[model samples]
Target: MPSRSRYDVVIVGGGHNGLVAAAYLAGAGRRVAVLERLDAAGGAAVSGTPFPGVAARLSRFAYLVSLLPRRVVQDLGLRLELRRRPFASYTPTVRDGAPTGLLVGDGEERVRTSFTRLTGDEREYVAWRAFYARTGRLAGRVFPTLTEPLPSRAELRARVADEAVWSAVFERPLGETVEETFADDLVRGVVLTDALIGTFAHAHDPSLAQNRCFLYHVIGQGSGDWDVPVGGMGAVTGALLEAAVAAGAEIATGHEVTGIATDGRGAEVAWRTDAGEGVLGAGTVLVNASPSELARLLGEPGPPAPEGSQLKVNMLLRRLPALRDPAVDPREAFAGTFHVAEGYAELETAYREAAAGRPPTVPPSEVYCHSLTDPTILSPALAADGYHTMTLFGLHTPARLFSGDPADRERTRERLVADALAALDTHLAEPLADCLAVDADGRPCLEVRTPGDLEDELRLPGGHIFHGDLAFPHRAEEGEPADQAERWGVATGHRNVLLCGAGAVRGGGVSGVGGHNAAMAVLGR
Candidate 1:
C-alpha cells in the first residue's frame, strides 16, 4: 500500500485547495501525496445527479464559482470554462397581495425602473450604485493583493486611503452601513443578504464575521460576479484533478488522514485506509480539512463548534415556474439569482426565531437556475423534455436548529423545506411543486441537504461552508503573529503545518489563494 516511505509533502485532504497545493509543489519537483477520506476529491465543489433516474446534473452541495483566480486556471493549464449570466438577479416583491418584482440587470434602464416602481422613488437605486462604486474602489486596491503576501493593517488602510471606506466596512457594523445606505427595507435586505448567506450571523455581528462574509462575497476577482462553471462544478474540480495527477502528485482517495505530528526533521501523516493503518513521512504536512476537524486529528481541542445556517435544496423542474409578473420572462427571471421572502425585517425575524431554537415561519432564501445559464448540465433527452434545475439556499438555519433531538431536527428541516418553498411559491403564478419532475418511484426529483446532513456526509466542523466563520484575509489589526507566516497568512502554530483550505486567510469560496499562498510559504516565494 505504501508507494514510498516518505514524500516531500503529505497534504491531509484532497479538496480542490489541497489539489492546488499538490499541483504546484509537484510541478516544482517536490514529491507530493494527497490523502482524501472519501472515494472522490473536490470536497464541497462537486456535481452529480442525486435524484434517481433524473437525467439533469445538479451542482449538489456547492454551486457556482466566484473568487477562483484566472491565474490559477492559466498556471495549472486547466481547460475549465466559466459562463457569465446576463442577468444578475430577479427578486419578487408583493404589495396589496399583488405579485410584482425587481429585475436587476439585463439593462440599466429596466433595473432602475424596477427599483422606482417598488420604492415609489429612485433614491435607493442611486445609493446602491454609489455603494458599489466605493466598494469597487476598495476591491481594486485589495483584490490584487490576495495572491501576494498579506498586507499589514496600516499598509492596507493607507492603500485604501478613503476614510469613508474604512468607517463603513472595516470598522462599523455592516447593518448600520446597510441601513444607512439603502432607504427601502427590501432594497436594504437585498444588500444585507450577501452578508448573511451561509453564515449564521446577524448583520450587526460585532465579531465582523458578517462583514468578512460580505467582503468575500463581493471581492470576486473585483467583478463580484459568480459565474456558472459550464459543465457544473465538477468540470472545475475535474480539471484541477487532472492537472494535479499530470504533475506527478500521488492522490489516494478513501485514505483518511487520522493524525499528524511534527518533529525537527520533518512532519508525519497517519492515515487509515481499507488496507490498514500507515504513516507517511513528509517534510511538511498541508491540511485542507476545516480547522476544527484538523485540530481533532492533531489531538487538540478545536474551537467551539462554528455555526452554519443554510438549507440546500436541489430540484429538477419540468419547466420554469411562471412568475406572477410576466414583464420579466420566466427564462430571463430564473437565469440569475432569485430572492424569496428576504426582506430586511424578514431576515431579522428568521434569525431571531432560529436563534431561539425554532425554525422561522418564513425562511429567507435565494435560488439559481444553473441550467438557465449553462444548458450543458442537462442531457439532450432531458433538455428536450423541458427539464431544468434549481438550487435553493435558505438562510438563518443554524446548526443548532439541527442539533436538537435527532427526530426533532429531521422534522425541523422537513418543515423548513416546506416553508422556504412556500415563501418562494407566493411569488410564482402557480405552486412550484407543481412543476416537479417525478422519478420512476413517483417521488419528486428533489433533495434537501440540511446542516446535519452536511456534518454526516462531509465531516465538516458544524458544516460551516467556509470551514469556519469567515476570517479577514489580511494579517491585520492586533494579536496577529509577526513573521513569514504573517506574510502569506496560511501558517499554523506548528512550524511544519500549514492550512490550504477554506480556513486559511482569504480561503472563502472556490478561491485557490489559500493553497497558492501555502505553496509560496513552503517554497519561500
Candidate 2:
C-alpha cells in the first residue's frame, strides 16, 4: 500500500524515464509516487550477472549512453562518469581476394591509409569526413532543442540555417543522401547503419522513418559520440533511483498498473499486486508505459503490434578473439563498434529477405566490447585476466520471424545465432566459440535475446525498444496544436494524463527527455 490513497502525481512505470520524472517533480515539493511492475526500477536500462556464477555483470538490454543531456545530470546532481571511446568504428571486408578492414577515428593518418587501401584512393575518405562534418553541425544546432518545448518545423529549419543539410536529413530520404555523398558501399553502409538501428526500415523508406531514427542517433547531446557508463548501464539507473528516493518520492515495485480512468480534471490509477488490487487517485497521471500498452489499459484499440527488428547477443570471452586484419589490433577493433557483413548491399539484401518473411542469408551486425572502454563492470580478477565482454546487435531480424509455433521459433533462433556467428567469423582469425568463458556448470557464457523473449520478460509489446517507431523531436510537418501541453509534447487525450516514456515525442534510446518534458508540462514551464 502507498503512504496515501492520493498523490499529486502518480507515475506508471519506473523505468529510467519515470525515475527522472519522479526525482524532478518530488524535488519541487510535489507528492509523487512511482509504481513499477517488476521488482526493480531500471526497466531495460539495467545490468545483470546473466551467466551463472560468472562474477561479471553485463548490461543486459540497453547499452551505451548517447542522448543523456548534461543539464539533466547537473540538475539531479547524479554521480556518473561516461567515458568516450578512442576508436569510432571498424568495418571488416575483403577487396580482390585479400582480407582488410577500415578503422575510423583511430588516427587521421591511419584512417586515411586504411580508406585508401580499401577504396584504391582518398576520395572516399574525404567524402566521409565532409559528410560527418555536415552532421556534426546539424547535431550542434538541433540536439539542445530536444530538452526544451517542441520546435515547429519552420523554426527548426531556420535554426539549422543550412537548407541543404536540413533537406538532406529531414526532408528527403536518408538513402539518397548516403548514395550521393559516398561511393564506397562499405563506407555508405557504416554511415547508414545509424539509420537502421532497431528500426525495420529500408534506406529509401518513403515515410522517412529511417531519417527519424538516424536523427536521434546522431543528435545526442550535440555530439554523436556514444559513451560507456563507468559501471554497467545499471549505474545510470542507480543514480536516478538514488536521486528519486532522496527527494522523498515513494517507489513501489511489484505493483502493475492495470487501468487508468481520467475525466478531464483528475485520474484514477488501478493496479494489481500479489495480494490484491488497489487504486490511487492523482491530480495528474504520468504514464511511462508504451502508448500501445496505455491504449490496452484504457480499453482502446491500439495500433498494430510493433515488431522489433534486431537480435541481441551477450557474451563473456576469456580473451578477445583474434582478427583477420593483423594490422589493426583486436583491442582497437573491438573498442568501438565492429561492423560484420554490414556493407550497403548487405544491409539492403538483409532487409529484403526479412521483409519477405525469411531470415537474412548474411546477417548484418555490429559488436561492442564495453570492457575495453570501462573495465569496472568486471571483477578485479576478470579484468586482470584479459577477460572481456561483447554485445552483438544483428539488424533485420524482425519479431515476425521469431513468432510462430514453439518448435519453429526454436529452430529459427538456432539458425539466426549460427548465421550471426558465421558472419562475424568471416573477419576473425579463429572461431569465436573458442574464446568462450564457461561457467561452473560448464555452459558457455553466452545469452541470446530474441524479440519474443524480450516481450515475455520485459512486457514490451512486440519487443519494440522505443515502445514503437520513433518520431521526430519537432512538431509534424502537417501541423500541431498550439496549446502549452501540446507544445510540450506530453499531452494525452485526457487532460490530466501525460506520457513520460519512450512513446513520448523526443523519446528514444536511454535519454530522459520524455520524463523532463512531462515534468515541465505538469509544472507549466
Give a tens-digit lDDT track for model 1, residues 1-525.
448879988898888899899899999999999999999998888899787777777887889888888888889899899999989988888866777777789788988998888888889889988898888888877787888888777777787789998877788989999987887888888888889888988889888878988888887877688899999988888998999999999999999888998873598889898889999999988899888987888898887888777899999999989988867798988888898988899999998999898899999999989998899999998898888999899999988888768788778878999999999998899999999989878999889998778888888778788888887666656454555555788877787888988888888788888888888888883
Could you tell me the TM-score of candidate 2?
A: 0.98
lDDT of 1 at 185: 81
Alpha-carbon lDDT, every model? 0.86, 0.91
Please report how far candidate 2 places residue 197 from its true position, in Å: 0.6
- What would the per-residue lDDT of candidate 2 be over residues 64-157, giving only the tens digit for each residue? 9999999999999999999999899999998888789899876799899989989999999999989888899999999999888898889889
Candidate RMSDs in Å, in order, are 1.5, 1.2
Q: What is the lDDT of residue 244 in candidate 1?
A: 93
**Best model per TM-score:** 2
Report lDDT (Cα) of residue 492, candidate 2.
Answer: 74
